[model samples]
Target: MTASQDIISLSNPVLLEKVDKLRDLNIGQHVPLPQLVVVGDQSSGKSSLLESLTGIPFPQDQSLCTRYATQITSRRHNKDSVDVRIIPGPRALEEHRKHVEGFHRQVPSNLEFRKQFVDILKTANERMGIRADVSSGSGTVFSEDVLKIEICGPHEDYLTIIDVPGIFRTTTQGTTKNDIVMVKNLVKRYIKDRRTIILAVLPSNVDIATQEILELAEEFDKSGERTLGVLTKPDLVLEPSAQAAVCDLVQGKKRPLNLGYYLVRNRGPNSGLEGHSELDKIFRKHPWADLPRDRVGIVALKEQLKSLLVAITQREFPALLREIVSQIAECRREFNSLGSPRQDEREQRSFLCQIAGAFQERARAALTADYGADSVFDQDELRLITHVVNITDVFNADFHENAHSLNFEKLGRSEPSEEVEMLSDYDGVRKASSIISDLRTLIKKANVGVLWSKEFVELSEIVTLGNTPMPMPRDNFSEWINGIYLKSRGLDLGTFNANFIATAFAEQSRKWSEITKIYMRRIIVTIHRFIAAALRSVCSEEQVRTQVWEAILQHLVKCYKKAMDQVDVLVEVEHRKKPYTLNRQFAEARSKARGYRATEQLYPKARKDTKQFGETQYVVNLDDVAKVAEGKNNMEQLQEDIHDILHAYYSLAANRFIDNVFQLAVDYCLLHGPSSPLKVFTQDWVINLKAEQLERMVGETKATKKRRSGLAKKIADLENALKILVS
Candidate 1:
């Protein structure tokens, strides 16, 4: 009787169940799964060993020796049963896969199961289009499809073994030269995986060095860690020398393996207790008995394989689980990128409607500054209202800095080499005066190259020059307004002309149009960027995103043009209309200016005194000052009043005009109202689209459909894989 220890199975049910679940899900196609693959040369007892292990009668005829690989799975169950199916290979076409999957059979595990099992194999071979003999060349010599056989019984050991086509050197009547190569390549494909434990079956009668399976195993597993040699048909070795060589090979004295070797006797078709007894009797004789008792016979080999499989499963399970989880995540991402299926007009329109609705919600949220905790609003570019407000603020600063005609603080001051002719209201002692008495002395001592032009330099540059001359001589504010005052003087004898004030105010605010237009352009660009990002987030299809963009782009262009037209009208009003204001500040400013004492001194005949030594002084003719003060225009008071009114009115108008640009041009035309471009994508707009337009916008390609299908299948497989590992 076989020792109890020799028949003990080390199979861990939990680990083997996980492996079986993954295998059934076909997860091995994506990631390598731990397996025990039986590979050997032709007639090397591979079929015999598989039959003994699985308790299934595999065909052993010379013509029917595993034309394609067979996956034999054995499980312990309450009753005896056999289930058979086909697992199509990677290279199988869709049509071929359907046909192969249709081949299924259930055989009763009774006395006649052997015959029924053989018939089932024959039927599977026919379904795969593998001919019984290739002499007539009607069918293929080999196939990538696999025959799956599942055996369940209370006494069966839980295991899975793949039996590939046996290696052959010569071409027979049923096999050709190409067939020989195909068989070797097929066998290599199975054993080459690092996760696979290679069971290299070798006949004891054959020379060990000449076996191709062992050489192939060594090629992939150089360290011999995963390769386990199985010396079969040990009873066939009759000679003492051949038997000694077989014993030496089994003991690892010759061509040593890391996993060592096992010796088993082929009991032909006998299995169960009868096969074990026959195998034990053959191993008891001569040199075979000298071999390790635990490394001989069918029972010991089965238990050893169970132990090795369980050990490798525990070793590689963590990494395999990680790979499975990684694959699941990647597959879901790709599947999502393809979006939901849209095969017909209804589905396509529904998909577009969903995108349009999402876009509208996001646009509203962005424009209203109602940013919830959504990550989409976290990006600065997507904050449309915030971006527009910032742009408005920058425009306000730029307008204040560059739009004014003069710097009001430096209005009454004279330039270098210039003198102000004024009628002084000074008392007995000297007061802080705006007059520079010696013009030529100051010009000579100045460091800058001063160009005393008859008029001012660029108004923008003049405003920037602090305490520096504006390249103009004499009183800059009075001089600037004197020209306009003279031209507009009519019946007003004591007061300055009102028309001149309007002209000055118009010139001061002229740059508003240009600055506002620049701000508008920035807002338009920000809107376009937001539209693009929102579209991409909602829908990934290029065709859909592009078509939707086109629909909205025309509207955006029109909105910008309308906004610019409105701005032009506003600027035109500021330049052409009369300077009139109900603002109390303007009236208060005029009254305040009239109440101040006259600072300007009219020195009609002022001569520089050369005899003053280091102090350059001017000698004033008091008699000529009286004559100049009595002139017609009263230009001194006229200039002072005009300066005050211009400063006050400009401040009031600047604030009003900036608010108008933001409300009428940006909010009404581009951002907020019904005509606004941001309202272009809505559910109503999607519903109103024509059938042809919807089709053009949402049509899907065949390749996209195929890719989506593939990814979906992958995700399903990987999800099943994850569940297997987790459970």
Candidate 2:
């Protein structure tokens, strides 16, 4: 058996399933077998070639014998017969009669009826058995009809050949009447299921038009289907040498016709024959005649038909079957990959809602306990209370100008708007609302929060309190403090503090400097934790771990860069500041600045510079702490450690998940294997053949034990091979 046959046998079950589905769905009407379409200029020997390849007789008279696309298939009757089925394009049958009359009348060619011209010529061939003389009128007299011919051979295998309308005609028309469109549609239909192979017949007389035909052939071959070129009318050229030269020039070794070309003859006894003596004569006359002859094949018209029957029955049809089965499998995989969109969306939403609920619960608890309900007459009231208490007296005094402006602004605006201004005093509350709104929207859209919630909180806190202290009215200290107390809001301060403390602890653990990092990390961690928890709680523990680790790594990269930037800025400031001078008043100011600079430089250095005592006091430390700090002051081990910790944690927590993903990737690759066409064909052939054998061997009688035994062995061997392939 051939490689393709082998694959078909192994994948017989799937192939059968696909065929059943096609039959059940009645999809065969839409997807036909792979068609080998032949097209060329009028009198270009297209029909003659089709007859030669399909072993079917095509009328050779000057009259257009085939009007529309005729599909030919091998049929089994008491005697072998070729069933010729005609599939006319829209309005093709009606127009065919008119086209024939028009061609005979020798009427002037109308541009509007250009397509109809080819159909008329085809109809004349089909019914009247007349050929239009090219010298009589323009090519537009021909009609637009895709001629289909199915040649049923004595054997089970037969190829469907589509003889397209000729391009060249005496008509004034500049284009091949509907030929391109028909060819394109043929390609689309064939490619849907079968691997379409184009057999382009190029006349030995080379021209710009022939070159264009070769170009189109190349474009059509990109569907991963094979395209074979045939140099026709070898007898027309007198010199064999000249003929070969023309063939090489027309069919170059480069793109489109890279598969090489076959020399053919379409007149006399050798007419419709490929690789015949006439063809060899042309090749021998060419410079590249030294090329292998096996790459080229030849036969007379009658012999060509016989050869085509063998080719289709033995090779092409089986290969086409393999291609169809493979395409079906591919379609199945694509559908599987897409999954159920609604289910996916619903799952995502559920996850987001869960995280959002958690966030809302935490935030509400913190607010109610920290700021009393009585204090929070509205959303802004809670902010106003927090702003009054968190701001430092000194900073509040500095903002006295804005504070007084607030009273006037408050009177001008609504109570809610005024409270919003006061809450703005504490940058945290001012920014929180915007940040929360954004978080809510993202959560709703993605059905998940940012994985790093701790980071965001840290960022908010730093931005709010980095340069200012809590601001409150000192004149009414008790009342001011009590107004913002938990008791007023019917909330417990301990509960609020507990939630705040947990967030604060997480921030310290992460050792993040920038409030942005804090804010970002908080959202990221929250998302990560939620996903991890949900996966663990609802799905597999391994999946939870895998997703959490992936999320953590993605967020870590973001946080690491932010931390590095902050460190760079700090380092730059320390490097640019000058040392202190205590002598003058300006010197005193410079002295404090220098001291602050020294502290900044020393702190980083001490943190980064590690010490080891070998000989104790007797040995001077080779690495100077101060110098090391100055050189590498930007080092942030704490940040790096946090990343390492997260990585290690996830690795330990989700190792199974990682392993599963890895295994999945490996399995996918094994199933697909190398994507080279030759390899795919071989693999598919093996699979198909095995499947076919199995199906045949499934049921056996005692009388057939001998045959069944051999088949059973073959099936065992195939199963073993399949196991090895999958493994």
Candidate 3:
């Protein structure tokens, strides 16, 4: 090495060494690291510059250096040593990483260093699955894995420099279009970090405007803050004008950079200039002599890079320390969330029991509506009781608003338009048309006095179940009731038959089946959703989650079927059995309904008999009113009474059924029983399972194990990095 190259201390050795250890710990994969990274276009003289700086001869050929990045780290130590290893990329497979990590070689000083170093790189390439020859085509042409070479000596400068794969625009025999994009992305990944000092390499012969490396550097560091341009092969630009342009760039006369540009003349394999002293002779003549002395040679470039790297490290160290502490806390939380690994059958069983206990605790919280401070309960779908009650409230409102088969007020106003009646017959029964006509006549007279009771008026304001109500016009309902009355009529002549009342009540409630099905489906879906969310929180492994789901599915199906059966029974009793309720609300409803027969329309109005005494006069006579009342017969009054009775009984039975369904079918069977679906997964259930079943139910998957291992390694690395920064 030249005496001028060693003129400056490379860096504060202690600070750079600390950062180097942190980089070696691979915490940079989680966060950015402070270092110098070399980036340029393909064939940009980057390798020759690195060889000049490190005094380690890199392969002069372009094929070997462009495949992967190389990291050269130098440390000041008591003994001289050189060790080489491969740090696998994030995408490397487990077996590939294992094989690559096992590669280690100690370069002996007795042998030639360049040959040994190049041979080691070739071996590392094969280990990384990159083909030796292009035509062989069995492996990749480029990789993200880094080749790490560490040098330690009594007088070595403590520094770290990374050479990233050169960016390429086209593909060759072994490389595809994908390789072009891959190389660019790899370079960008390295230079994008704010802590990385970019050494943008440019060949002096190429047009500066066309070089890709400067464009990228400008893109990432838009302020030109951390980039330093290195112009190589200055002797190749022989023209006076072009040489002045290069001199102008070096002096910041053209495109200015914060830390401007440096010019270096490196010795190629075929170049006559064998050393730095020989190269200095050419710069002493002609146009290059006009440039400043500090920006002209390899030694000056090294000193500038060393000083810049040290400055960046000193400025970013505290921020990096805070970042490490933050990462340690976050990674520790994620690692703990994965829980302890289960290795054997006993451990798997115990793990399953723990999950089950957690499941039961959350499930109990849902069942009782006891949502405490846990964020999991914040989601509406997970709160089982609240969801069930909201749906039940909708069900109750739906039944009250739309359960009855008839709307009496609407039917009374719009009577059937057809008038021909009293002739058709089928199956030895009266035709529905004749009954409709007869019933319409009665409704027109009875509707004047009809008014909705207080209970029915309030039910009108409640929201429906978002479904269209069953259409039963008054004429159709009257026809149906008359048919029932005829069939049930017996020894009761002047009075109405009570048997038809049950039949009318049963017919009005036929919609209970459809409405109940909708309600039950909602409850089942809510319970199933809550179960899935709870299981996901408790168990991290997908296989175990699936097994637990299968176990719960069986119990869930049984519970739903049982609940539906119970619901069907409730419907059956309402349909097949007699209509009966001991509540006093029935009496008030019956009295209100009977008032329809005595409307003000029944009274006769007195008309002017004659224009008396030159003025119009009106008179009210008792005889006229008595005659109007006497026109109606016993049969009409009986039909009106039966109609009123049917309406009163339907209202009474509907409210009773709504309460029973929410309590018995929903609460008792599916949500609260000993065999409830919510209680299917428990510690008792895990204890009862066989060893093989437990193994299948709770065993950790390969992906889970791999993730846990990765997190454990990351946490250890971060903790170590924190210690290095603090100490």
Candidate 4:
């Protein structure tokens, strides 16, 4: 059998199955056809172009002649029958709500007035009228509304010609704001499908070099649909030179896309035969004239009525149907893939549980190490360290909060009051002094000589107040305290107290500075060794060794500087000549040291504290870590849960993919073959009923030629069969 016959035969079983499946699916039945959506600026000849192409005298002069998106379909009827039915535009309820509200506001006193006014507005908007109004007590008030028209003609068996509202007008006086929104909604709804082709009309007067057309083209191009540009009102150009100039302006400019443009004219009374002929000659000479002429035919308003009938009823529509079917199938595949929903929650749940368990174990180990075996600390040294950690945590949290909140504060605002600063200073002094006293006791217990006599106490007070360095210890008591403090602080110790310690120590330890240096160096080396060992244990030795060494070196340098600051602060306090200068420096130092010690101690501990973190890494085979009870209830439950989740996801994806394939196949068959249910439904009911009703009621008939042609073919086939039987 031939390709056509093969297609028809294949469609029989397929079409039947599709019909049954569609009923089972309960999807809306749609008659597929190639859609040519005409769009342009208001009064930019969108309606005129439709009239020209279809030969239908659509109310071109009506102020928004195409208000709603009208869809036109071509159908074949019996001999001596030609039908034209205007399918009503889809009711845009959301758009109409604004109009209804506007009417209510305009006529607040009369409920009936608002109702009547809105009704007229809706009618006028849909029919593409200039203005719609209802008479009130005062006078007739006009409201803006636009009309949208869809002209169905007999050009092709399944081709649809849609006339859209004009865009890029200087004024939308006749079109309501909602009308514009409606047009955009229509474009989004139709163009997103990729099955529809957009025929954008541009006025010849607009500068092609402008950003307007470029942006418009970009919007359509990005949608992944085929968009064609038609330059309308060529007849108005009058001069051949002007037309050529316009063409060159469009063609020469560098655009986002290599958009094709066509010159078109809508036949009008002003556009006589001579004018049309001249316009035609000018269009033919243009660089883009080689496009198929039949697809780009031009006709006058009166002639449009006849041409449209022929165009809508012709075999060209069947070819369009094939193209639309193919496009929709492609779109279906893409949409199905992207729109697939999340599947098999049970499987996801099981995996989530496994991840949770791993994190829980890690969390417990961390909490125990950081908080210690007992929840409380009785040792003076441990209590001091814990207090420092608490203070550091508070400072870190507040600093982060202030950093973020400072941006929101009003500009040119005064700083916080001195009372607040004094209170903050008091709190800092109390915490630091308490921690220092505890440290003194711990040092004595550890066999470090008592370094806190009356003189040392006075020096400690001065250092605390002014961040000054104290005199070098006679014994190595200072070295012992520094070591204990640095050890407790961990990695963060380097960041928090580097500056304070550096300046204080440099001045205070001038006499035995070299000995102080030796003690500080030992502490730095010890911290680095600990950090490196910890890093090696957790991460790969090969990958992290270099990074660990670099980090340690940086921390040591930072801590050395802070230790020196402590010495400097103490020396400055001792050498000051005037009490005023000493007091000022002391106040400044106290304020500066508010969060330093706490910050230093907390920084290192924070790095090691991972109790709060859950599931930093995932590892396979739980059996490797612990024995698995194969037949245990808990293990069985976990295994079953994981299995269910995996199966669920797989099943969902498989079902969805299969359903998408089947649906696409059904749509393809319906759009292509003659015996498809969609075709039969459209031909038997939608087309036939509308045509018969229009003839019986409206007493209007446009063209009967297509119906006559179908009859002639049928009769010829029957006669040939009879002759063959006789022979």
- Top-lDDT structure, candidate number: 3
- How does each model score on lDDT? 0.74, 0.38, 0.75, 0.37
The candidate maximizing TM-score is: 1
Candidate 4, residues 192-298, lDDT tens digits: the string is: 43334556676666655542433554575674235656667665675656666655544533232233445576665455444345556645644436434532335
* Number of backbone collisions per candidate: 5, 100, 0, 68
TM-score of each: 0.71, 0.33, 0.68, 0.31
Over 4 Å off in model 4, which ranges? 1-34, 75-158, 168-179, 210-214, 223-225, 238-242, 249-259, 272-727
Question: Mind giving the per-residue lDDT tens digits that candidate 3 earns over 271-345?
Answer: 763788787777798788888888989888888888988888877776787787888888888878777677787
Q: Can you write out model 1's per-residue Cα lDDT over 95-211, one digit (the tens) per residue?
A: 998999998888778345676877777788899998876676578878888888887888888888888988989988877899888888898888888899999999989999889
Residue 232 error, candidate 3, Å: 2.6
Candidate 3, after superposition: displacement of residue 715 in Å?
3.3
Which scores greater on lDDT, model 1 or model 3? 3
